[model samples]
Target: MTQSYKIVIPVFFIGFLAGAGFWYLFSPALFDRVVSEELPAGFDLSELRSGEFRDVDGAHRGSGKAQVLVSPAGAALLRFTDFEVTNGPDLEVWLVKDPDPQKSADVSASQWLSLGPLRGNKGDQTYVIPEGTNPSEWGSAVIWCEQFGVLFSVATLSEAKI
Candidate 1:
């Protein structure tokens, strides 16, 4: 090969590697956050038990849906059976426990989980809370669409039985 051609090949390869590496390191969490914010308006958490959550048409930047379940007091026990995202960027799911539902100051730290870019028919992924998190204190669980900046939150009325 010509000298210039050899140099061009190596440069292209290096660029590809760099891009892939960057995505690998940051894409999951970043995409999740973006999708978390893009959740649709009037999307109900209670409906998730039925196994399908649909977003309002054209309300958000992208098209996607999410479901959430929590203890009566709002602790998240299982998240994922009712989840789906399509035609959008990635989504992030978080579990937040707050003793005082009206105030943000009483909220416990949040746990971040990642989902998908989901161009077509992406599957669901479930999350189980750790033992340290008290089920009764859980006030809300949120699913965020990172790209469109939407947040879908479900609040529990009492402590979860499980």
Candidate 2:
């Protein structure tokens, strides 16, 4: 109603909008997403070979349990539980020969097989490794960003003493 009040309100609204836009664009990886999927009723966890996720390149954080489980009929799956990690665009799950990769070049520097595009940046997920490919041959698992060539995280695979 006052002359100064009208001008001040518009200026404040514009500033708020600008700040929100900047936050959304610049801090994409900070967002957290949780997704859930049901496992097959007959799937057995007893036969799984398990591993623990680790951070790499000082650009990633968070940890979780990784397991390679086989179905009763003989299909292989990579499962992640209690999983947490930073979010990034074009992130794909990769099984790699190198246990610790510092950059994108290292991803292709040796033999690598993609489990598939990452299901979610945070929470439990599963991936099916191609039937003929041997999971034992790969040393570790990597959450890689295909578009920007960034390694989000890595997990070294090892046999679990079940």
> What lDDT does each candidate get?
0.41, 0.78
Candidate 2 stretches with Cα past 4 Å from truth are: 1-27
73-103 in candidate 1: lDDT tens per residue? Answer: 4444344433444333344544455322222
Candidate 2 matches the true fold with a TM-score of 0.76
lDDT of 2 by residue, 37-65 (tens): 66667666554566788776466765998
Error of 1 at 139 (Å): 2.8
Q: Name the best candidate (by TM-score).
A: 2
Error of model 2, residue 111, in angstroms: 1.2
Residue 143, candidate 2: how far off, in angstroms? 0.1
